[model samples]
Target: MNTFEKAAHFALTAHEGQIRKANPIPFILHPMEVAQIVSTMTHSQEVMAAAVLHDVVEDTSVTLEEVRETFGDRVAWLVEKETENKRHNLPAADTWQIRKEESLLDLKNCDDKDVQILWMADKLSNLRSFFRSRLRDGDRMWELFNQKDPEKQKWYYSKILELCDQLQDTTAYREYKILLKAIFSTDAINLQYQTGAFHFEV
Candidate 1:
């Protein structure tokens, strides 16, 4: 099997029992969708492999070292960049914003453009899922997330868009922005980019 096939198998095994909160689908579908999104941007087997393995470290018992041993350093590094640093000693409520902020910083400071593209694909797939869920369940969809505040969700996602602004020309980036606008209404971030008149707050 090629690297991507191996990564896909790894991810499916890692996420065997998990299901998406917004839908009853297997959680492995998220990584598969992310890989699909990344495939649209590049044909690199490593990038696509990393996309498939992105959530294994964060959501499963899998460790970065295992990823390195299984997939090599490049795939491990991409997965590392994609994984959030969840300060385990702290309560999730207390660490949520900090983790997200740090993630944005990593994206903004990333020297590898492919890393950013991989990250963008992940976000696009997530936002697309959220948008579809909202359409089906309306305001009830927000209840599925740990962070229930709509404004905070908007703030977090919008900041990611700002951080990934360098990729604005990509189809994933544009689709992410459009989904954000539809889900959150025309917020300051949307207006700022649309007419260059407003500044985003939070």
Candidate 2:
């Protein structure tokens, strides 16, 4: 098998029996969708492999060293950029903002465009899931996340849209922008009186 195939197999095995937090869908499907989104932006097998493997080191017992040994340096590096420090010792809600801030800082500081592709792909998959769940459950869908505040969620995703503006020409980025508007347009309107502008219009 090639790099992407190997990473997909590893991700499937690592995420065995895990399910999405907001729905009963198998967790592996999320990474598969992310990898698919990544494919729309780049032909690099290493980036695609990293997309499939991104959550393993962060969510499972798998180590970065293991990914490096199996997939080599470039794949592992891209995965590392996608990985977050979950700060498992504390309540997830308490740590949520800081973790997201750190992630944004990393994305802002990194010069590599492939890392942006990986991040946007993962986020687009998340937004797709959020959009589906919102259609079914409405605002109640926010209750499933560690950070239940929709404002904070909007801030994080909106920041991603700003950071990934370099990818504006890609189909993945365009879809991401549309989803962001669909999900947050109401919030933008609600805040219009105070902020004097619609923040999410694309």
Candidate 3:
């Protein structure tokens, strides 16, 4: 099998029995959706493989070494760029902001467009899920996440929109922006992005 196929199999095995938080959907579906989104942007196999494997190290017992050994350096590097240093000992809620801050800083500084593609793919999948849940559950949907406040969620997602502004031409980027506004309200999102007022501590 090719890199994307291998990574899909690896991810499926690693995420076995795991379901999305507060939803019954299988966890592998998230990575699958991300890979599909990444495909809409680029045909690079490494990037697509990385998208499928993005959460393995962060969410499973899989290691970077294992990924590198199996998939080679480039795919592993893409996966590493997508991974977060989740301070596993501490409460996830307590460490959420710091983790996101670090991720955003890295994305801001990274020159590679592939990294941005990976991030956009993953986040777009997340925002799509959020939009669907919001439609079905309304305000109560916020309670399902670690960062329950919609304002805090807005801050993180808006920063993503700002950081990925260079990708405005892509359909994925446009859809992501539309979903962000749909969930957060266009006026509020516009004000937050325009004024740089989304930096408050959660």
Which structure among the candidates has the greatest lDDT? 2
Candidate-wise lDDT, in order: 0.85, 0.90, 0.88
Candidate 1 residues 109-185, lDDT tens each? 88787788788888888898886676566677878777788888899888878877667888888888877887786
Clashing pairs in 1: none
Clashing pairs in 2: none
Best by TM-score: 2
The TM-score that candidate 3 achieves is: 0.90
Model 1: CA > 4 A from native: 186-202
Model 2, span 88-162: residue lDDT tens? 999999999999999999999997999999999999999999877776676888899999998899999999989
Q: Model 3 over residues 1-202: C-alpha lDDT tens digits? A: 8878988999999999999974679999999999999999999999999999999999999999999999999999999999999999999999999999999999999879899899999999999898667656667788888899889999999998889866779999988887887778745444444563432221
User: How many Å off is the CA of 116 in candidate 3?
Assistant: 0.4
What overall lDDT, based on C-alpha atoms, would model 3 receive against the true structure? Answer: 0.88
Name the runs in model 2 displaced over 4 angstroms. 187-202
Q: Please provide the root mean square deviation of candidate 2 (C-alpha atoms, Å).
A: 4.7
**Better TM-score candidate (1, 3):** 3
Q: If both were scored by lDDT, which would come out higher, candidate 1 or candidate 3?
A: 3
Q: What is the lDDT of residue 161 in candidate 3?
A: 82
